[model samples]
Target chain A: MWDGILTGLTTAVMPFNLLMVVVGCFAGTFIGMLPGLGPISAVALMIPITYGLDPASGIILMAGVYYGAVFGGSTSSILINAPGCASTVVTAFDGYPMAQQNKAGKALALAAYSSFTGGTIGAIILLFAAPALASVSLSFQSGDYFALMLLGLTAVAAFSGKGQVIKALLMTVFGLMIATVGTDITSGTTRFTFGSVDLIDGVSFLLLAMATFALTEVVMTVMRGQHNEQEPEMDMAALGSMKLSREEVKEVAPTIGRSSVFGFIVGVLPGAGATIASFLAYGLERNLASAKEKLKFGKGALRGLAAPESANNAASTGSFVPLLTLGIPGSGTTAIMLGALIAYGIQPGPRLFMDNPDVFWSVIISMYIGNLVLLILNLPLIPYISRLLAIPRPILIPLILFFSITGVYLVSFNTFDIQMMVLITVIAIFLKLLEFPMAPMLLGFILGGIMEKNLGRALTMTDGSFSFLWDRPLTLTITLIAVFVLLFPLLSAMIGKARTRGAEVAVNEGEG
Target chain B: MSITKDHIGGLVFLCLSVAYGYYAGQIPLLPGDEYEPFNAQSLPSALAIIGGVLSIALLVTADRSVEGRLKLAGYDFWLVAKLLLLVSLFAMALPWMGFTLSTILFLVGGYWLLGVRSIKTLLVASVPFAVVLWFLLSQLLDIYLAPGRFFTLMLGV
Candidate 1:
């Protein structure tokens, strides 16, 4: 085992490998900085290019784009209050406010430092934990896979915030319904194509993703009218001059350490993703902080920003663990990447390690290098990238549209795809306007194919006994966990209501 | 803006799903002894039922009063309509123009419709982008992008 790891480490240290990591990180940062373009889109857009690369190098480049884009996303969120993706929304809550206060450099620094710390710690944990997790998951039956999908779907309810959960669940169901499009595996029958030749294979996840996340967002922003706000100039001089006190660093250090571990664990669980990991970390940190400290959160609390930043980065890093080891993607970005890997003829199961240790371990090793490069690049270069936000929305929006169209066409060379992109974008706009959450839809689109294949495979394995879900203890445990996750919100709500009623009764008794 | 529109939307989506599910259900099953009885149609049919129920739930839970209808007017329906139209046009023209010219047209018209102020800046910025795209996609990547029909006719493919 050590031999494989050491070999991977040694192979990854070559100059060409190092260059790929740097270039990947560089491109990821720029892509991440662009509005409506997150790591998922960046990776998807670049995956085709990586086809010619050796599997390890290809994976390394893609990994760079993934984590590097994440780091870059924080820049815009902190500087302009525009989150490039959903995971960075929390960062914007406090990050941009600090930037507004002329603490852009400081905010950027903290974000970078925290991201590095969290990412490195997460990588270490992933190095040790992913193999173990994969080994355990290797024994999972189809029922277990179904149970996992159920749990993943339930997260939409958990993380959809204080919004109308019925709406979120409705969207999730709608997403699952959409996922049902294309040929059904068991019957070899088509679903939902309506006689369109383009959809015999079902709605493309890539098309759906680009439409919902990227194009739909563009439409909404355009329809909302060009935002006229000038980009807040980060006081670059002030940014360089200010420093975190040793005492302040000490305070957040433990929080960062704890959140990193928490985030890594959450990320390793398929379907949890970065947003949940960050929120979970923040909730945990707030509970541990003093009352005064807690009050400071969300209102420029360093830990407020630090915890989520660390946790989200860790989660991002940890998500790759499952993708690399088990061939199961933990998030949308990784799923798209799995498609890319397949396109490159690198099958993504346990044999990935045995077939090509260089591919598996080199990609992991590149991540460590990518994070260091990103930290160094971000610490000094943030001010320059923040200028990108100043580009008029008119100019930026068009370019974005151009990129989306071109990127889509380059891969398929099919006009049918362009049509598909537009249709999906239009639908996505309507869904967004109706307050339907897009994340679950994205999750559905990515996971839908996987879910269908596994469902069929499991049924074939079990001869149609629905009890296959509970046949194995592991599958049963996953199902139970999913049940708990699904019920958690309702249970918590009931408890809160009871507590309120009890408080009122106690008050009445005291008055009497 | 009416509660009826919400109901109609839900009804339309649900009906579409059911119709889709029915069609998917019609595919011939493969010869297999060890498959789940649930075929392509099963999950989709289940989803259709789920969609139908949820739409009804949304309909029932919808606010019934006139004030509820008034709230819909505030949601900038014009913007959505324009976006839908633009996307349709882009999708239609993309095949004829290939990626570059088609994208330029879409972006230009989209930005103008969406509200960009300066044409000079738009062109200045957009042309170089077109050039770069040509070089990168056609030259470096070797993707055989379809030429514009008019251009193809003149240039002889």
Candidate 2:
């Protein structure tokens, strides 16, 4: 473990990898300041540019972007009360108040410190926990893999949003269907290519990712008109020293600590990314703080800013856990990362830690370095980052479109893939207009191939018997957990709705 | 006019599921696979069946609260259509115009189409961006950005 860490640390320090971290952090922060672009889009957009990079370099860039985007969210939240993403909504809860009180610099400082603490602690946990989990997962077989993948799919579908469960699952199934294109691996026969030699190799992962994420995003941005983002009104006078007094640090220390742990735990859960973690952290702090301190929440409480900032950054790190160890993506960003791994022909699972230690360790070490760079660069540099918001939407959109085309083209120099990407993007936009969740579709697409491979293998081992699903204890246990997780929310929602209907009937009867 | 997005979406998925299931049956599978109970077509067929069920469920309980129309006659509608047109044009022209020229034209035309009026913004955003990216992708990364068959024939490079 120590050797891996050292290896990762050394790889992370190499000039090119270090440079990617800096560039990724800067770009992420700058882009995150935009009202419309969040970390997911930011990471997605960069995929084209990172296409030429090695896995370690790409992961470093991803880590930097994750941290920078989270911090950058604070900038918009604090300055304009418009968070770049939903996860930063809680940052605005107290951050804006602090700015209003002319303590903008103080708020920014606390946010930076708390983010660093959360991120660093999260990285530390990841360093130890990821490998341990990977080793434990060495026991995973075809059945276990199938169950885990199901659990991943279920968890994301269950929690992605309210009233979107069926839609999410349908999309997931559709993705699985899409994965069936081209030659069937085991059979060595064509499936869905329809006589097009272009698709005999199946659809490119880059094309699907670019289509669903980047291209769909471009269409939406153009159609929605401008975000009409308001100019950030940073209290320039309050942009003074970003120093934290001893008492101030002492006061928020416990809140940061608690939030970091809570955030890390929440982050590890599929579908519950930074937003939930931050909100939970803030709620926890509010509940535990003394009456006076509690009153300061959503007003100008330092702990208020500290808690969410820590949790969000911590949660971002925690989100990487499943993607690295299980080959299961927990969120849209991680799903894209999962796609990246597949593109590099490196299947990310338990074996990744053992087989591709350099890629795994380098990424892990880069996380530690990336967050450190963010902390160092955030303070005194935020005002400059805010300047990026002034870039017109029209200009940025076209440039992004250009990059999307170029990026997709780089993977395969053919024009057919580009054309397919555009067509898929249009379809994706229509789906989005109908309120479909894109994340699950992308996740399903990536996992569908893996799931089918494992499902077939598991059944094969059992001689075409479905009973093997239950004959294996661990697989059965995992599948049962998936079932419970899926049904629990649905059942609760149904019960709650029925009770509400019953109450309404009773009230009308009484009136009659 | 009273139809909602969910209604339309549900209908589309219902039809799509049937089509997908039919297509899955058309894909040939390996004969005599002793190692596995299922073939490549098995998972896709199962997915289509499950999708059909979900689509029916959606169609039955479809929400009508949200408005469904894209307002085809409206400005926003045209904006989307125009963007699509520009994208299609770029894709169609890529082989003739080459990566550099087509990208520049696409960005320029896209900006103008999207209503960016500032000439300076358009030029700075489109022309230089295309050139820099040409070098970055072609020169630095050694990605083969087609110089267009027309350009190749003309320049004989």
Question: How many residue pairs clash in model 1?
Answer: 1
Model 2 residue A178 distance off true place after TM-score fit, in angstroms: 1.5
Ten-residue stretch with the least lDDT total in model 1 chain A: A222-231
lDDT over C-alpha atoms for residue B46 of model 1:
69
Candidate 1: stretches off by over 4 Å: A10-17, A34-55, A92-101, A163-166, A185-187, A227-229, A242-245, A291-299, A342-351, A501-512, B1-13, B28-36, B53-87, B98-100, B114-119, B154-157
Q: What digit string (tens of lDDT, one per residue) describes model 1 on residues A274-349?
A: 8788888888888998998888777778888888889999998888886777676777687677767765777665
Tens digit per residue, CA lDDT, model 2, A1-512: 88887888788999999999999889889878776667887788787667677888887897788778878888889877879888899999999998877788888888888989999899989888899989988898999899999999888888766778888888888888788888888788888788999999988877888778777776776676653333654545757667889999899998899899889989998777898889889999999999987788888898889999999989998988998998887787888888888878888989999888888999888888888888887667888777766676676677777777767776677788888987898789788878888888888888988898899888888877877568878878988989987887789889999999999999999999
Query: Where does candidate 2 stray beyond 4 Å?
Result: A227-241, A290-295, A498-512, B33-36, B64-75, B118-121, B154-157
For each of the candidates, give the backbone clash count: 1, 0
Model 2 local distance difference test score = 0.82
Tens digit per residue, CA lDDT, model 2, B39-154: 87788789889999988877776665645443333226577777777777887889998988898889989888767788887888878878887898779877777678787889
DockQ of all predictions against the true structure, Cα-based: 0.47, 0.63
Q: In order, what lDDT does every prediction score?
A: 0.73, 0.82
